[model samples]
Target chain A: MSRPTRTTEESIARVLPELDYSKIALSLVVMLFFAFFVSPIWTGLVTAFKTTGAVTATTPFVPVLPGTEGFTLAKWTRAIGYLSTGFVNSLAMTIPATIVSVFLGSTAAYGLTLVDWNERLQFGILILFIAGIFIPYQAVLVPLSDFWINLVPLVDILAPVWQLPFLEPDHARLLSLTITHVVYGIPLCMLLFRSYYLTLSDELVEAAKIDGATISRIYRRIILPLSKPMIGVVFIYQFTAIWNEFLFSLTLIGSSSSPAATVTLVLSGMGVDLSGIDFGFRMAGAFVAAMPTLIIYVLFAEQFARGLAEGNT
Target chain B: MAGSQDTATGSRTIGGGETDWRTRVETFSKSDFVRSFPYWFVPFSLVGMGVYGGIGWNTVISLTDYEGFDRPDYTNLDFSMYAQALSDPWVYLTAKNTLVLLIAFTTITLVLGLLLSILLDRGIRYKEKIQTIYLLPMALSFVVTAQFWLWMYNVNNGLVNAVVGVFGLGPFNWIGNPDLVLGAVIFALIWQYSGYAMVVFLAGLQAIPDDQFEAAHIDGAGVFKTYWRVIIPQLKSSSVSAAVVLMVFALKAFTFLYAMFGQYRVPKATDILATLMVREAFMLQHWAYAAAIGTILLVMALAVVAPYLWYQYGQGSL
Candidate 1:
């Protein structure tokens, strides 16, 4: 019986032939991508047009082709009308923080690349920064909040100079958020920028020096412009990252009274109804809130890929 | 044609300098030396603020002795709160949950990623397309992906249940049950993140010289034997990298878990230290105890990751 079974297996193998399993696997990958990647993305796109009821129907995504033009445009309306206000606040916070971090980070990277120091001190600091990237924000959550409170003095100093209204103690969470993202952004951002900048032709610097350009002027004139590709890469990524920023936003922003809150805060406002059902509104809210990041990604998709091909620093 | 003045320079021609081109150019006085204090800004202003902020915020909260919207008083520096936090109900459980999730996810991601990397490195056609597909999930924010996964894991109308039903099992409460929730969360994360690990491994694999493989092939070595002895050993750098990256990922595994399981009046069996810390300080307002818990987590992370970090960064691997 065993011999017959083996013979049968052999016969079947001979008849069908053992196909190139790699091709078969590739076919599977194509299928998975279509099924997993394409379908979800299209589903998400369609969801942006969906009214709340049509989305959570008995067959949820059935007839995903949309005859439900009752679409009432309410979700988009609410997203832009209400949430854009909060979004602007997020931008106000993120822009300065992002710009400050990129400049500060690239400068540090430049300095590190040029200076000679005790190997341990140099690399050890690099390690600290790298490790800092991995440190969970939660581990530092409590201390971070208290520290924000103490910034009243610094805010007081800035208050006299800039008269910035957001510097109030309760609203000081934005300052913390800005500083934290800067710290988080700096580690990898600087490393990548430095790595890319190191690839620059030293002749340029020598020429600049020959032209009698100061060190700071050389950085401003030569390095900054040359660093554009890396800077843009950092900006697009940092933009998406900061826009999606939630945890620190959720934790630091001390209740709702602190200016406008983040989109995550708005989404979390949907209380659980205990039906084991995904509260459709929250999903809808999330899709709406997440629109800007998605759009930014879509717009910058080409540049993002080029940056990836240029690859991790 | 007119006398060029470092004409190819990459700069914004400043307007504030000497008005006449030749007057500024003949002598060509360089910009005045500025005291490059921004060097200190990166540290003192940016990194220092965060570190000091973290240390100060936590210390003050720990001393405040507050608990959950109740008025917090900060008269003393006692650490009974630390003892209380350690012994708190569900704290040990949450810590265990975090470890299990971290270990399980890290192991799965590494193994699957390594396998995928090997397959990917086998001179396959359409490699770039395969990579792009694998990397698609990484583009989506966790906050968004969690919603999609939540839909897939929906008990009645979800994909997971439908598949399980086909296998003749009860519709398990994947997000509800204490014992199963953590595993489900870890599984989702592995699915979401393994591709990233695969990409890192692929880069590492490519860095291995082709001559090594050629030598093995020249020695009458078979495919499996060559891979076992030649390939896997060289994959260590990537392995360590994947481990560190995934460990960091595990430490901050919150968005999905939060989206899946909402509103914990108290910490749950699935609540990791991150969410636990948030709940304590944000939800419960137990500032002192929460600060203690936060410090413990920091110490734990530093204890393990610091030495490895020093090795990698010092060696210029990162």
Candidate 2:
């Protein structure tokens, strides 16, 4: 019986073909999906490398293969030179804002757990932070702009009387933008750290409590060390977010002629010229602007992906 | 000394030997509540004032008829801005566009993302590499995506036209034609966002047990049937979360369009409430009217979120 079964299996294997149409079709579908997602960026890269005249004349989808006349560094030079101020401004705004917001969020998250508050109050505050996640940035646009515009005059008036260094009118936009981003960042970072801390066992906190460590002491010594991974996660998340943020940057920091406007604003501003828009230069600038985040993403794709996924829930 | 001792002893005895109120107050200052309060105060107040407070202020501004380089008059408040917005023809057009974007973008992205997730989950070779490729665009700023797609959707020399022209189709105007601009914008947004939906759906798919697939196979179900009946139904939570995020982002498409066109005043065909709000406020200086539009948009956003919040509340995760 075993021999017959083996012979049957051998006969089936011999009769069947290796080639499968379904597999081919599925492979084609997946390939198409990938091509659909990748084509635009691939074209952007190709166009960025091409001369301005070549970009307009040649099909964007076609790559400038080696030994081609399409390649040019002119666009890159022009784009970088144009965007240098915005690049510096983005770094200036993003670095301090990201660090401060993440630090504030982590501390607040730790305090939230340690506070011996009423359950309803604690839950209410947590909900407030969560609710901030869904509030359309538009909802805040008018009032925030209103606040900043009004505060500038106050600063100018008070600076001379108080014998203090007044915020320069030009730097007002920068100050307001940094403050707005830092404040807006608190909710998401706090939520991320809160959820992260929730997963940790509190035996360490309890042990510290028995040793007469105060709430701040326990958090400083025990929770902070244990929270290194989460701190990195929150830091990367906030850094990416504040770095890429557009609407707030656009609304708050519009063309201050200083290190205030973000690279995104510069990239978008490139499109404003109706007749003289250079596709090569614009694409090159975009590639330049996106380089930092893209490099960070390549290095920490898993953590970035995980943080975003966890953040929404 | 005798008087102080008598008062302390009287209070202690009267309070059934518990510490007096003043001593309890001192001890409370050393408790976790006092220690932790200072830590939470700055973030909570800042977020509260910046976000919720802004919303409150926006609502107030919408109630007045303030516009064009003037402080909002706090004396008289009414819904005239909302009433005016309700009657405006532009408002109607933008509202229709917003609804179209929200529904169309969310549905298409969710379906495509689910398809990709299923394809990847079925033991595909180089799955990680493929996912990373699909997801790489998500890491890009909206400005980049907007500019990239603007170039791609160019009529004559764009890659989109280039690909289709090979099949004997002539180049079509993508961003130029009013009827096609919204679709083009939605397509670009979906391209940038579907990877996110796929990651979400993939996470959901992985959470299901393998025994369910074997059980379906044993029951003589085909590949399509197993996923359609057993697996896809289980992805409801993932779908809900992805849809909410997508729809919320759909409302935010103002930034994408503004970036693409490089101005607050986008094409009338593509203007959603967000773009309209910005244009009305900054360009035209119809501050109160813009605030009214913002209020409406907020209501729409909250409508999308209310159900999710209710679901979480029901689950006791609120």
Candidate 3:
């Protein structure tokens, strides 16, 4: 079926103007737009390699000429050194949060779909979850901060847990931020998972039930295997989201002074404090902070796009 | 055995009033709703307590004169903080900024994205690669983008100045100058999210059947006319969903501004309600006033989102 359609499309393409003037102009327009879109990233990449003196001495768009004093890795080294703690903190918070939220969200979505409950009640509950996606974090920020601050005493009460051989002092703040991400993240994850789950054939679920499969067994045997693609999409989406998050970390973990500062908070702090830092170091820090998401986007661009598109749907 | 007992009890319930309540309760316990409770209860409770509960707490705090670590006086709760906010000039200024940001950002991004999607839809080569290039920025943290743009907007030796210099424009202080700061911030935000709008529009464009385009062509309609008249009109839903998402992001532009300025007091020109709310609560310790401002921001966000939700629900896609 697709073969005949492909041939028709090819014939159409062949009959059309192969290299018309308008086509050339349109391509040029797109190229220029892409160039403008990528200029900042290009500037940051080139600037990251330039020496501090060269960064100020030359225009931002100019590349650092190799075999000259312009090029150096000193800035990268310093940035990594300064950002190491933040990198660890961010990973410690983001990984567990992403995993836990996706797990909870998937289970809830599966459960919501498996039952033959009242239609209006199900939708009302679905809206309750979906509404979280819209509630401006600002609405919850004051109480959220108060809640965390109040929990510090509880952390003290559980100090013995903190002193466990596996734990550190900063673990309290990291754990709190992780929990915050999970809480905020559940709605989005559930929305994505539920949308995917709804696409599933209800007869398959009914068959499993008739076969005496428990809810957990059906979920484990059927849904989990089919959910791989969706899990990828949601994982990438939530991972980048939690990693890129700033407000929650800034509000909950305080500042760079705190041992629990995420990479975003530290990077922002680096941008502000220009006392001895140069543009080279700042750009390097920005790139370093952005590397994980950038790598994910480069590797999984299709999944990333699908995640955004499906998220809105 | 349980099913037999249930039927027996159910029949008896129909004949006897005393057993009716107990049987109904038993049936309710065995219903799907109760059976599925284990799956959804955890997430439901977490979001309920974290999001809904926080909003409730925030609203309660807003009613009191809460500030500077003094415990809130719940006994004398009222709308005094809101009244104070109403009288404050900064509130109006930030509100104006927020509205401007919401409208300008959403409109420009939508148009630009629509244009890109249309252009790409014309069978452009290397389309996916180009789309990814455009979209790569959206994946980065706001702090990273803010820092990158801060450099790009630097008065001296920055790319913006360099490009404008060729056109004989003065090197503008994009960040420091109050008159230009809001526009500058909006432009950077557009840079980050226009790609997202483009992707959404692209999906919408792809969903348009090829027959529609051919039909328009056969009717002697030009490419521009075909899109402007038929294709674009069909994209109303796409435009709406993208616009709502963009508007919500605009309301959250506090992250970008805060990262750029690294302070609660962002420039007055660029201060939206988000920044104002944070400043009031965290910096000045005007907790109640900030909560009031947050409530107002929440209402504004809902004003933008509620219609979209309603539309989705009406479409049975909720």
Candidate 4:
């Protein structure tokens, strides 16, 4: 009944084994590396909260001084005010682009996976899509610019529609940006979805097929529902990529004016235009520009990690 | 199949061939190829036109001396742009820098990531929280990271210098010095992406069976020895995949440099083929020259990715 009168020291020893020097060393090393890894972000956080005077006066890693208007949301407000237009433009561009690309790419992946085609042909088609993922955007930049310029006339055909009350003038540029992102995004999205779709059991598709379900119907009823987790993964990955995209935005939309610029473009401009704005203000803008993706990462870290792991390998 | 064929022929004769044509049309429409056409063909064609067509057009432009605001002269074309690129010293320098960046960045990040992953795998507590902290940087845009590092590398009050100063080192111009610029850029990039490498390697590490570690331990191998011998060799595939991705990212690091300097003309010390290509085209309007450079960059990227694609293809994963 007394469990052989087990001693406290025996139980303690059972729970916590003898100390290992290597384990302790490993932990210490990891802790040090963590500090290095987080130092920039820590610095950014501190600097973003400091007053303009305190930012330059104090070390970057330190918090604001006691007497110097300790912490202010002024920088954040000012930064957001400057970036608000670009922020909206980015949302306008990123949202539709992500949805369209994901939808189309997923459908394409579904087709590739389930369609009865010649094996060589299917493999060939997949290689074609996979090749697109590796093509440096620089290779296509010149022609893409030319293509967009040529497309302006076609876009202008919608001028009457663009003149509607809710549409802004910058919507045209955003539309162009959206189209660019969608087209470029398709390959990646298709690759990711196709890989995920490949893992799904063939019996699920075959069972639906035997029940007189058309491919599209089966996709809508069964595949799409089953693909929710994958959709989430691809969505977060593409959203972050498209949101943080700079070259396409810079090359396609340019930093010409406020209304049409993406958040990355505007943030780059802020960094460049070192005029009256303080370091805190600029850092705040950078943080603001990065917020959506950061938030997505924080909330969907598992999906983000899954996406990275699956997408790469 | 026999019944359908019989019906097809019987209807062909009896219905004046009209019903047969309709039935044939219905049969063809129901074929797998036709049924799945919308799902695959539409997106495939779009990518084809956008990416392949763009590359084709860029190559055409590069063949011609297309500069300034004028339309590219398509009728007359030559290899003169490639010739010029080959002859230019700046091209050589930038190409060297690109190669250096590609190799150095990939190797170092992989090593650091490997180290981190190994440490992380060793029964660390709060593993998820620790990994998330390390990975948070990867979630940020290069624009944000560049800003953070710019401040970190600032000559006077920068965190890097501040820490170094504590060790009796003088404030150094990390961004300005030619010798330090590339290394500084590489360090910043490593800071951002080593976490990615770690995550990739961690997945690799976890996939190794625990029995392997137990076997190694039973064989009197130390922890370091077990990882070095029994564990790391199995991670070759992981390393290959990670290297391919990291190399691709290293090529695309034009965004980071662009954000850091906020200009096409970055510090000469850190100027890569990407920045140089953009500057030549957009700034100098050397469209043909830039197109040539872009083509070269594309070839370089393909060189890096081709083996990976082939491996995936060989594995029937494609």
Instruction: Categorize the docking of model 2.
Output: acceptable
Q: For residues B1-318, what per-residue lDDT tens digits would candidate 4 score against the true structure?
A: 333455577676777667867888767777667778899998999999999999999999999999998778898899999999999999889888888998999999999999988777765778888888888888898988998998898887789999999999968999889999899999999999898999999888778776676576567665566677888999988899899999988876798998888788998878889899888888888999999999999899999899898897687655
Off by over 4 Å in 4: A1-18, A65-70, A152-155, A166-168, A274-277, B1-24
TM-score of 1: 0.80
In angstroms, give how far residue B247 of model 1 lies from its true place: 0.9
DockQ of 2: 0.43
TM-score of 3: 0.93
Candidate lDDT scores, in order, read: 0.64, 0.81, 0.85, 0.83
* Candidate closer to the true structure by DockQ (higher is better), 1 or 4: 4
List, residue by residue over B1-318, the lDDT tens digit for candidate 1: 022344413122544344445444532342221223354235534664565456556666676677654445677668787778767877887788789888999999899778776666665567666666666666666766666666666776555676678899968878767677777788778777777777778777777776666576667565556678998898787788678778767876777677555453423667887778777777776778878877777777776677776666577655
**List-wise, what DockQ does each model earn?**
0.19, 0.43, 0.55, 0.46
Task: Sort all candidates by lDDT, best to worst.
Answer: 3, 4, 2, 1
TM-score of each: 0.80, 0.91, 0.93, 0.93
Candidate 2 lDDT at A289 equals 89
lDDT of 2 by residue, B6-99 (tens): 5666667667524687646556677677778878888999998998899999999999988888888889999999889999999999999999
Choose 2 or 4, whichever is better by lDDT: 4
Which DockQ value does candidate 4 get? Answer: 0.46
Interface RMSD of each: 9.4, 7.8, 3.4, 6.4
Best by DockQ: 3
Clashing residue pairs, candidate 3? none
Q: What tens digits encode model 1's per-residue C-alpha lDDT throughout A14-43?
A: 434663553476467556644654444444
